[model samples]
Target: MTGPPNSPTLLREMSERIRALGELPQTSEARAEVEAALGSKWWGLRVLAIAVIGAWRDKAWLVERALRAENGMAGGRFGHARTQSWRDLEAQTAAKAAVPMLDPADAGWLLDRWFSDEPLAFAFYEYVGLRLDPTAVERRVAEEFARRRSQQRRLPLFRLLRLRRGVADRDARLRRLAQGGDETALLARDLLSMEARFRDRQAQTPGGAKRAKVSAGAARRAAAAEALAESRRRAGRKGRR
Candidate 1:
């Protein structure tokens, strides 16, 4: 929703002031001025102000002040809490925060919640986090490996594909589905193989594996079955409804 970093005139003034300070600005007055500029009507000004401050990590005062300013904003408060619902933003913020003062152990937990058992997101974070701390990142990745083994203890796929095939190889849902019988395992394995193939193809290119595949046909069929089942259950729900 916000515009470019330097979009606002007030933000430009803030930048000029920050540039004048050269290093991180030390004075409480200067920090307050930056905060005031950031509090402008345009959200972009706030982003710029925070960004400028965060860029100077050596300035603990500036970073803390910027964080305080961010916490004061509506978006920072409500938006951050909403991270629990929106995995993308949650993962991004967690990954960014992990790079700063947060410990690698903490980063592992943050990455876990952020990825929400999504293999692709987990893999992406693993790669990025590696750049920050290789040993720690790899250890975090081992969690996913453990998850895969745990999932394998469940069901076996047959209908769509074997449990060993397709998208089932990577999807966390496949592990859950495996708890059922042959049919569940089969469908899960098929979906997993499909996802794996798609991801593999993408990984052969520039961006590596960032995209996730969802099957429209499969989703529609599954939704229809659920709807029919719900309709049948409606008979029992008549008085309750």
Candidate 2:
């Protein structure tokens, strides 16, 4: 729901903000604007709330701009409603705070983008805007990712086989996609694993260490198991169809 930028509540809030600022002897209107908003009743607190909880209007302009760009709405003259990949948009938006000195109008854009159904948008805006700059944010993110990975841990055998080539936290995302039976995720996992194996072979060739070779019997059994899994997967797809 797009509306004029200023609303009744916003106007009253501004008046209260101005009144709060005019109280001080040395404060300019701009400075007073900041201070009054910082000091007034609910209005001041609202500004503070925006700052702490990741304000869509104050800090997330770049993110909003990205969403608009992705939606092909860069001109702002509304076009035909376009389908959007919300997840990809969110990932890109979250990646923005990692960049420097984004524009302020983008903040307005972000506010417009802040719809309730977009949980990832809200989560990412909060995460990037608030948690990004702590001295230890990266460490905290890594720890959280690790915690989730551990809680969902598979067998040690799976880990050994998966990492015998080298699986990292990125693989955890792949695993999630596969569990969701997402074809894109399955294809991505296959490509990543193939590339990893190729690189491993290239490394091992220099040392003349033969790659781990599956015995013929073991290979046959593995192939049979894979075929059964494939059959089940195909059946599931067909059933859904």
Candidate No. with top lDDT: 1
**Per-residue lDDT of model 1, residues 1-241, tens digit only:** 2446556664566556655543565477766765685566544444455555555443344324433333344234445644323333333333343246544444554445433422223333444434335344335444444455433322112111211123433245345554556533544454455445555665676655443244533433443344335444554687487
- 1-241 in candidate 2: lDDT tens per residue? 2334455666565655454543444335455445444444443343332232122222344444344444443443435443233333433543344234443433433323332122233344554334333223323333333454332222211212222222344355345534545443344354345445544554576452332343322332343345345546766898899
In lDDT terms, how accurate is model 1? 0.43
Global lDDT of each candidate:
0.43, 0.39
Model 2 residue runs over 4 Å out of place are 1-57, 65-167, 179-189, 205-241
Q: Give model 2's TM-score versus the native structure.
A: 0.23
Predicted structure with the largest TM-score when compared to the true one: 1
Candidate 1 lDDT for residue 24: 65
Candidate 2 has its poorest 10 consecutive residues by lDDT at: 151-160
Off by over 4 Å in 1: 1-11, 58-103, 117-192, 196-241
Query: With candidate 1 superimposed using the best TM-score fit, by how many Å does residue 53's alpha carbon deviate from the native?
Result: 2.1
